[model samples]
Target: MRIAVIGGGISGLVAAYRLRQRLGADADIVVLEQGGRVGGVLHTRELAGEPVDLGAEAFVGRRPEVIELMSELGLDDQLVRPAGKRPLIWAQGSAHPLPGRTLMGIPSDAESLRGLVDDATFDQVATEPQRPLHWEPGADIDVQTLVGDRFGSQVVERSVDPLLGGVYAGISASIGICAALPTLATALDNGASSLTEAVRTAMPAPSSAPVFGGLRDGYGALIAALTAASGARFVTTMAATRVARAPGGWVVDPIGAVDAVVIATPAPVTARLLHHVAPVAARAAAGIELSSSALVAMALPRETPLPDNSGILIATGEPLRAKAFTLSSRKWPHLAEREVALVRASFGRLGDDKPLFWTDEDLIAAAVADLSTVTGIPIAPIEVVVQRWPGGLPQYAPGHVERIAALESAIADLDGIAVAGAYLHGVGVPACVASGTAAARRVATACIENTQR
Candidate 1:
């Protein structure tokens, strides 16, 4: 059998690898990547003579997909955990401990945000449960509107934005309530008396397991392992123009006919490819917008006096060009042993693309200035690496869940075409891995059916 996997990001690579396992050695699996490299946003490089991730630094360890894959690849020794240091939030020109016992910064109780917000805002949050809440059962809305209206704008900006920004490269305003905080939505739907009560009900039970994990050698190791195991022919620096049904299966333009096709590109690219085969999905996919961001990973002298926190997140409207900083040495034990201290500054957001246009020198300067502002320490980096990810993350706008459902349903009727991408579900690495595996399963099953027929 012949198969085509479009896009070479984590999703596509995972799909290719899974296909090889399911379809056996005789099957020809080809990965078509528009970029020259396969990892896509999961790039890693050497800094200060050691590996550092330029794209995604870590994966949610609670999700077993990533860790399971690592074990399967004999990369168990590369697994590493964080130092369990809590991150700080820079708000109102000062650093404050990130509020605990909160669901992504939406405090379960007002007491958690004591010193972070003003008196009036604090009072409002404290009495929030007394106020009657009106929520539609299946309603979908942006996080800012719901949060700002209920908990006050301070809560939305100071608490919600900082946490959401790290995950989506966007503030609460750009993210949807249901998709980003499904548990909270469920609580509301179950007739919680107020937002405060809903937040309390939705809060996950505390666990002792580490929240995140990373590879000792960076994500490059994962990418290399997946590529080697897939044994697929790679067509890089080329795009799949279109996909349509052929005589026995499907044809991915520029790659010829294949037994099955997994459209693993971004939302926009997926929309384009499915235009003719699945118009309903195409429109829904096209509606999903993307956000851009840039990163400045710097190597400073190990003696630099940075904070002991894992990272610092700047509250929305903060007078700073960077949104967050990951103090790598403080967060990861493995990274701390390096010759130089490592820090990563993130720039831009969903609605802001100005940082992507800035030169490397400009980004580095901003990182230095911002770091100095937040940490109250001198900033001097011996080496710097800049990476820009334009349209890297997709915005989970209001009704995102519905849109994805419609897109998936529309494509399900197709004989040998499947879809997998970050835009379809959660944007994290584990979700992408799950998506790729599911797509490969669907395509492999279809190919087997065709052969039987």
Candidate 2:
């Protein structure tokens, strides 16, 4: 059986690797990457004589898939936890420490949010339990609406927006509550008396393990390891333009016939590839919205007085142009040991194309200005690196899960075909890994059954 995995991102790599494991020497698995290299957004670069992640920096340690995958690859000892985890919110012309005991900015204790929100807002939040929530079970709703209705607009803007914005590059008013924050979604769906109480009840006990984990070297190592272990033929700079139904299986354009195919590219790319064979899935994939972002990484001199915390998240409506800032040197212990300080500032998001229109120099200037404004530090950086990701984040709008389900149903009858990526499940590394592995298994099983028959 032969399987073709399109788009050599982490998902595609994982799919190809899992396919080789499942089918052993019998399967002809190949990975086609249009780019010059693999790893997709999981990119790492050298700065200040040390490795710094220009793309995804870390993965949630609580997710088992990533940990299990690392263990399988003999990378268990290479995992490095953050030295500091407290992140501050920059708002109202100052930086405020994010409250502890909160779930996605939803504070479990109203008193903990005293400095974050106004007294009136706190009073409203305290009285929220008395008011009955009215939400249909399993129904989708915008995150801003649900949180704002219960906790007031101040909480949504001051607290929730910054956190969600950092993750989705989207406004909470448009992002689906359930799709973005499933834990809070469940509580809301169950008609919880108070969001605070619900969050407190649902909060997991604190663990010594850091919430996030990263490789000692970089995620690039993981990608390279997967590529080496997969033992699949890799075709670089080859884009799959189309896929058509052949007599026995599918024919990927320019790649000849394959017994099975996994479309693991971005939603729009996947849509175009499937347009000729699966129109319903194509339409659904095309409908998914995406947001673009840019990161300005700077290597400052060691004398720069960086913040003690992990990073700072900029609340919406703030005067600063940058959305957030990560003190890479402080957040990651390995980076701190270097002679220079590494910092990353994020720019642009959904509905904000101003940064996208700016030249690289202008973007860097803006990021530096914002960093100085937020941190009250005006030191010049020894080096600057700018990375732009067009359509970097997929926005999970209301009814997104249902739309994905419908898309899946539309293609269920089609043989030897499966789709997977951040668009189908959670956007984190672990979730994408799981999606890729699952897609590989589905296509592998189908191809094996056909061969047996």
Cα lDDT tens digits, model 1, 1-453, are: 999999999999999999999999999999999999999899999898889999999999999999999999999999999999999999999999999989889888888899999999999999988888989999989999998998899999899999999999988888888898999999999999999889889987789999999999999999999999999999999999989888888889897989899999999999999999899999999999999999999999999988999999999999999999999999999999999999999999988999999999999999999999999999999999999999999999999999999999998888888899999889999999999999999999999888988
Give residue 265's error in model 2 in angstroms.
Answer: 0.9
**C-alpha lDDT values of all predictions:** 0.94, 0.86
Once fitted onto the true fold, the runs of candidate 1 whose alpha carbons sit more than 4 angstroms away are: none
Worst 10 residues of 2 by lDDT: 188-197
What lDDT does model 2 reach?
0.86
The estimated TM-scores of all candidates read 0.99, 0.96
| Clash pairs, model 1 backbone | none
